[model samples]
Target: MKLDKELVRDVLLAVEAHDEPDRWLAIKIPGKSDIEVSYHIMLLAEAGMLKADDVGSHDGFEWVPTRLTYKGHEFLETVRDPEIWRRTKEGAEKAGIAGLGMLVELGKAYGKQLLKERLGIDLP
Candidate 1:
């Protein structure tokens, strides 16, 4: 599946912050729209990279916690490939999104395995 780089990034951000129970980790990622974030979740599910656990719910919305499948982790590694890295860097350069620097920092914070868990695209 050709997951958008932006969406993949958001998924990784959210899964890494899985420890936080109050809100979504993707929300912390800079400048992402609501649709983009939600789409990442859907894509992850559709790709079978992310598994939804019935963590129950509050109010009308179900509170499902997503866990990374082994395949998902593998996929994330692909995201870190040199090719993808170059694309990411070029895109960031073109957009002048200094926030991408923060993503760089996040990549370091979460480690390589976390990336696979969140994005479902593996890195080289």
Candidate 2:
């Protein structure tokens, strides 16, 4: 399955809101199947954004995220706002940069721009 950063962000938000541990539940993301969500969860775990347990039964393994890590929380904070996320994604796409790290940096820059605009104070 292809990596969807939006989905990743959504999942992180959900996990952050839940604030629980060891509870594996299905999260609903529009246009994404359960398997796809599971795949994204696995990716998040691999990215060190979440801690998950591989619970496989006779059928298959299910990835269950226990909680968000420090990095995950940081990333979520960077992309939580809808406008910031949209701008960050657009800037990254325009620049042809498609890495997670780069996207985070772009989001940070966009967030700072938004803050500067909101406060009308030039940020050095």
Candidate 3:
């Protein structure tokens, strides 16, 4: 299945929200159900937004660690500007409210509840 921009954005959001950076710093995204997240990471990698490196093996399975490339960090900085989000939403006619809602939901269990709370966003 092809990965979409929404999922990719979610992945980046999730990563940046990690307080235990060590947890994700050298770990491949977990759960087989999240293949699309991995696929999105691959696309980001190709776009030079992410870099994948082999960390080690797990039960005979090769584990790859993904980290934000410089470009990814830059993108994150840009998106943090509410103006960019506002303009993007306006130009694309996308549901920014719904998108932010979904992101908050993902952040709930992904170690970002404090940040979400500080931002006055509720997560599912």
Q: What lDDT does each candidate get?
A: 0.53, 0.82, 0.51
Q: How many clashes show up per model?
A: 16, 0, 0
Give the higher-TM-score candidate: 1 or 2.
2
Write one digit per residue (lDDT tens) for candidate 2, span 40-80. 88888987888987775789757878788899889889888
Model 1 lDDT per residue over 1-124, tens place: 3335666655754675586544433333468554455555665666666665433346332224356667666556645565555555565557555343333543443444456777875766
Worst 10 residues of 2 by lDDT: 19-28
Q: Tell how far residue 106 is off in model 3, in angstroms.
A: 25
What's every prediction's RMSD, in angstroms? 10.7, 2.1, 10.6
lDDT: the better of candidates 2 and 3? 2
TM-score of 1: 0.45
Score residue 111 of candidate 3 by CA lDDT: 28
Model 2 clashing-pair count: 0
Tens digits of per-residue lDDT for model 3, 1-124: 6445455665676666655544444334455344455556556666666665433346432323246767766666655545444444443444443333343333333324444656866656
- Which stretches of model 3 miss by more than 4 angstroms? 18-32, 53-65, 89-124
User: What is candidate 3's local distance difference test score?
Assistant: 0.51
- Using TM-score as the measure, the top candidate is 2
Ranked candidates (lDDT, high to low):
2, 1, 3
Where does the lowest 10-residue lDDT sum fall in candidate 3? 102-111
